[model samples]
Target: MVEMTGIVDVAARAGVSVATVSRALRGLPGVSDATREQIRQIAAELGYVASPSAAALPTGRTGAVAVVSPVATTGWYFNAVCEGAQEVLAANGFDVLRYDLSEVETNRRRVFDTQLLRKRVDALLLTSLPLTPEEVEALHAMNRPVMVVGPIVSGLPSVRIDDVEVGRMATEHLVGLGHREIAFAGGDPDDQLGFPVSPDRRIGYAEVLREVGVEPDPALTVPAKFTVEAGVAAFAELWARDVRPTALFAASDEVAMGAMHEARRHGVRIPEDLSVVGVDDHDMSWLFGLTTVAQDVRAEGRIAAGTLLEALRSGIAGETTVTTVPTELIVRSSTRPAGQSAS
Candidate 1:
């Protein structure tokens, strides 16, 4: 029978005392981050597993991080962020627990009001989940290290892209192509989920249109969820109008692709009869030849997780840290000059 490698073996391999190994493995104070990482690596190499009950006795930390999101992990953006954060947390001997509160209202309330107070996780990562002032206060009252991804929450560190700028860039691209009548396909500003992204993008789009001397038309703006089916319905509504827009700016690539598919189904050639642009260079954007403003969702998640880990290591809750991810517009065959021939 093979014997299990013990902490003494990990300490010997890591060139550290067994006491120090115990401290590092337990995630207790008094150990440098570098030394802790080295000891962890050595322990992993030697097939050493610390007893959970023993480890928790000294540190009172579960060594698990909780990620809270408003939506399920099925979407590309949500999945990418979770994957990136999980990679970093797993590397540091920490497990990730995801709380997806998208499906049921009772589940969302239970998580925020009662479940979080049980102190199950060492830290919290909130992604695009809108919080009421009361909920934010409740989260702060927990006294756990908290980091946010997406919208800015007061008294919390956050990593997100400038959504308004993303909207402006998408609109400007179509405007630069001499498109005068442009339509926007996005979600409602005051959605039930409380995501402010759609509203921020709408502001950017309107600002750009006014700057270019084009009067923004309320009739041309269509509200829809950030999905392909919603985009199809939104585009259909816009198409049925007496004055169809020559260009379309979708809030997400999935929406843009859907609009394109619907347009083609109605015999409207892309970039010929109409031009299209979108935000979020989604996984299938290339397959559909979508032009979009691209933001790194995975990087945002990784950075948010890294920030929380740093706070846990340093034990400093100094000032709230805010990191902004940048976006870029990628032009493709999906867009062209207004009234130009589609090559």
Candidate 2:
């Protein structure tokens, strides 16, 4: 009996997974152009024949949009955006399938390394994710419309606020009010998830600080994930510093509220001992009288979804359009001029 050369041999020779070999041979979108060509050549050389099951591509519309997040998708912003998007997509007779990696490597690989990203949705909506060059190529090859929220990518349609402007606006408000030593607590400064929101805002804040001759202090920035508890921890980190900031610019209202909560515990008074500001005029921002740079989060989601729907209707499958939303600074009692008592 002669051993037969199979798809496995082709995949091994091509240094790709069996699934990738199948996708490349079947003319699916997940495989990049270069990789697909390489796989084809290798398969032909090996005389590999794909079974009918392996070659068949699914037909018709999925009636769904994929909402992918590089990290966890349980934050207030994520929820609000999805709610707005769902309201629009549901009304339009489509479903939203979410794939949140929760910052886990396995989940991330599973979503990106397989057909999960390419086959299951008519369109894709990414939340603050920046992809690799290969990933971008794969997306382009798939030929589906892709939209992003909270980050900008070349050739990709996105709906997000001008994050740099949001940061500059927040920082300028604090600076204008005579608060010099402003601390920031928001997304990770390292930005391991590779989203533009944090970095762009960081740039804005730094620019504002530089214009006023105040250097941005690395000690004052904290990676407070967008949550109240994370905010509390981040504020504690800031309070522990030898030269604490008199004013804090939290990236979100939840962080501001949590920081405020922690401030009270340490006998530091809001606006009196330490002025604070945040982005995202969350519902609770009003309850806490928290001043924030407010972006219409739900409306952003709606706009993102609506754009994807338009692409579906028009058979447009590229990430070329960008819809920018407006952001407003809402003043409340949480921030005030740094008083003499503040140190």
Candidate 3:
């Protein structure tokens, strides 16, 4: 039998006190982020297994769930999902520990490599984060229940919508309105977190165009940061082109709102001059009269949280299941037939 690494060994390797190591490993507030990370790295290298008694409560569990999100909780989708998840978790007597990584490589690495392994959370809820194979394996090695809220990662249970189908619905709506010269405004395909939705949506858009015998125009596709400001700038670039599109398909409602604002600034009429469609029926979609493909993001979060809770109660780990949320196209007054005059 091999020897197990002890806390003192980890403390010695990391050049920190045993108490400091304890604080760091438990994710307490006393230790600095850098020091905590170093201690965790050393513990992993030393193959330290935290004593179950070190993290156990009177109830025999931490009673906390870690919710990992790649971005801040400002966006509508993120905020709604978090709200829904929090509601369910809180009702079930579990506290949520939110870890917003800002889609930074170092932050993501630290969370996956060290913080998660600290055994502070009973389960993990990953929201819209694309994990590498190694990261997934690390989570598996933890032997704790894990749930995903967006984009399926192989061998993990997830709750999400068919992003490709979402893109197709948006594009099909534009095509049905007699739009031939159409543009796409969406998130960068190469974002730091490796999010697959942006690229998947782009693929769906291109596929629809090809099916209709229309060659997808590379020049009309613009990558942005999935924010209203980014959408405005992207639309400006498209407007600068000599051959402007008659309609645009924004990847999200915020982007569509930005495009509409930009068009208004340029004295361009909506529907008459340029029709705009987007995904996600944002709160302001009705105010802007924007057409969009809508999904219940908050409901997805609730379901994801519930799923994790179920797995935890059953004491089963690594049982893969997939739950797909549905989406629908909501047609407002934003889109009209191509070449139609303003009423």
The root-mean-square deviation over C-alpha atoms between each candidate and the true structure, in angstroms, is 4.4, 13.1, 12.1
Tens digit per residue, CA lDDT, model 1, 1-343: 5786778889988899999998998788999999999998888777789765566667778888888876673387778788889989999888898888877577678777635533678788888777777888887877778888987777778998898998899999999999989999997545764678878888899999999998899999998777888888888888787558889999889889889998888888998988999888888898888899998888888998898898888988636877889999999889999978545
Q: Against the hidden true structure, what lDDT does model 3 obtain?
A: 0.84
Candidate 3 lDDT by residue in tens digits, 197-295: 777788888889998999999899988766788779878888887558999999888888888998889878898899999887988799999999998
TM-score of 2: 0.77
Residue-level lDDT of model 2, residues 172-230, one tens digit each, is 99999998889988886555447667667878999999999989989978888677887
Clashing pairs in 1: none
Whole-model lDDT values for every prediction:
0.84, 0.82, 0.84
Compared with the true structure, the alpha-carbon lDDT of candidate 1 equals 0.84
The C-alpha TM-scores of every prediction are: 0.85, 0.77, 0.79
Off by over 4 Å in 1: 1-47, 114-118, 189-194, 341-343
Error of 1 at 147 (Å): 1.5
Q: Which residue pairs show collisions in model 2? A: 155-319, 156-319, 157-319
